[model samples]
Target: MEEQSVVLVVDDVKTNVLIMRQCLKEMFQVWTADSGEECLRVAKQKPDIILLDVLMPGMDGYQVCRQLKADPETAEIPIIFVTAKDSDDDEQKGLEIGAVDYITKPIRPAIVRARVSTHIQLKQHSDKLKFMALHDQLTGLYNRHFLAERAAQSLSAMVRHQQELSIVMLDLDHFKKINDFNGHHIGDLVLQAVAKLLQDCFRKEDVVARMGGEEFVILMECGLDIAREKTEDVRQQLARLNPMGLEVTGSFGVVTANPQNAELSHLLVLADEAVYKAKADGRNCVVCYQDGAYLTVEHD
Candidate 1:
């Protein structure tokens, strides 16, 4: 079952807060705040929509909306001004300052419910579209564009923090033979299973992306020895996984470096070369590139 969307009702009056809560209780999980200060602080709860009262003391709804819109962390949340201020200029100001909508006071529960539902639906649709743009359609992993963007951020971490980053390039050995024997449908299923394995093997903070086809890249914040061990784990697990009742194995190329000295692209090229050596030495093995040489990481 889908969870209820969170709605925050911000009104200085207890009665107004209760009324708005009653209006949205059936459709959303409602949170209430009596002041703009409290609203800004409670916004850490990350509500999906905010229904704000404009005429309140100690920072009006317009001020809260401006702060929210100015901060990238909260800017995307939809805001609706529910206020007694019915002047044309007031409504204009609310809308211009980033409120998705403006609802005048003497609140109608029906109108509030209708508008909230509509805006929430719009937000959900937009979020889904954004997810599609960033993710691989086949494996649900981060796509190439998303990887490049995230890699830029990781590169900054390397330069600013003197962080060591490990890059692993993985390719399925004889993947074409698997497809030629079983057909592309089975090949797709194999790819999905491998994608899940990669996700399971790495931490959430790690950057795991499917570059294309049977090739995938993983970026980890660690040194050479740790990366080689992690890469060995992936190789051992993939060898054991008889996904779809067929044997599946992968060749891994591990490269660990302080990325201030090398870009992400250079690391990938080095890893790709290691993967090539792994394939030539016979598949289903982990190879590490270190000290200007490739060494096969032997695993039991």
Candidate 2:
């Protein structure tokens, strides 16, 4: 089920807040704040739309709009000025300072609800388009472009904090045969199932993506030990999959980086090498590149 959008009402008058809340509560989850200061504070919770009263004792709506627009974190929130001042100049000023819409005092509940609904709909559409651009259509995992950009950002922070980072490259063993024998339809199901399991296995903070056909990558902000442990779990999970009477397994190549030395290109190359090693060591296993060489789990 889709969650209701949130609307924040920022007004000094308790009566005004109550009226707007009553009007919007059916369509949205409503939150109220008495002053611009409280509005900014509640903003961290990220409301979908804000209905702000222009006239107040401290920090007018225009001032709050200016501050919100200037901060990247809050800049995208749509603001509507609900004020007693219905002058053209007042409306012009509000619009110029980043208020998306304006509503005059002696409020009409229907109009307020309509405008808020429109803005929320637009925001939802915009967010959906952005997600589609960053994610794979088939697997619903992030695409290579988003993965590369996000991995770089994560690597930078890890470098600053002097932490370890691990990159894992995985390829389905004999994926083409699975597609050929089981047919493309069943192969697609296997891909989607694998994507879901990857999401389930990794921590929410980890970045996982599909790097085109039959290959995927995971960027973990953890040392080699933790990365290996998680990768082994994923390997076991994949081995357990029997899609359409065919066994499924994945070969994983993992590489670790220190704060001062992590480069995405280098890590990817090393991970690819390690995964190749896993395949050569007879698939369904993990090979980790650490301390200047590739290391694989030995069988007794």
Candidate 3:
């Protein structure tokens, strides 16, 4: 099951904390702090949202907010200032200090609930939009732009860690033919189905993307043997999906990153060539780029 959203309620007054907790307990996992110092300590646990009271005895909400914003770990968490100071200056200060919203006290329970719910929903929606922007809409996999960006970053990490990195480019076999016969809608369904299969086969950390049309790419921080195994797994999965009537299969090409091949574009080209070889040898197979060449996997 998914984890419940967590909220941190910070107020010097016990009564105010209790009231806020009562209002939020139904929808969220709640934590409270009686002082700004304690609020900082509790924030280390990383609550999804924070309800902060501005009129605390020591280290008020503004100071607490500034401290939270200063810390890289807690910087992204949304903060809402709940205070009796409802003046224009108070609101301006709260906004300027990076608080997302402000609610004046003697808080209305209904308003509190509504505002919290709205912000949480907006956060969730914003996350979805970010995912969509970086991923293919039809396949629900990373798109070309995301793939390139991720590949470059992965390459940089590989260099820093002195680790091996491999890129596998997979192109669906005769994908345009499927669209020609089955209509574009069925083609889209087939792409989504294939994407789900890929996600299941690869680790969550591995970068997987649909690089336009019937092509997809996988970037892995693994040796050649493991890359081969993973490539075969994806190929077999696609082949198994042929019974779905779209007749889907994939040809894969792999290229490992080396000192001689530092350029991402160069590795992609090598992988593309290997993919071409897989098609030449007979589609629906995997090929590895080795010593600036591609070798096909021959089966008995």
Regions of candidate 3 where Cα sits further than 4 Å from its true position:
1-7, 24-48, 54-74, 84-93
lDDT of each: 0.91, 0.91, 0.88
What are the per-residue Cα lDDT tens digits for candidate 3 across 1-300? Answer: 777888899998889989999998988899989999999999999888899999888798999999999999998788999999999999999999999899999989999988888887777788788888898888789998898888888888788887889998989999898889888888888888888888899999889899888888888888788898888877887787763565788899988898678678998889999999999989999999887567887643
Q: How would you encode candidate 1's per-residue C-alpha lDDT over 28-130 as one tens digit per residue?
A: 9999999999999888778999999998898988999999998888899999999888999998999999999999989899999999999999999999999
How would you encode candidate 2's per-residue C-alpha lDDT over 134-190 as one tens digit per residue? 999999999988988988888888878887789999999999998887789999999
RMSD of each: 1.9, 2.4, 3.4
Q: Which residue pairs in candidate 2 collide?
A: none
TM-score of each: 0.92, 0.90, 0.83
What TM-score, to 2 decimals, does candidate 1 have? Answer: 0.92
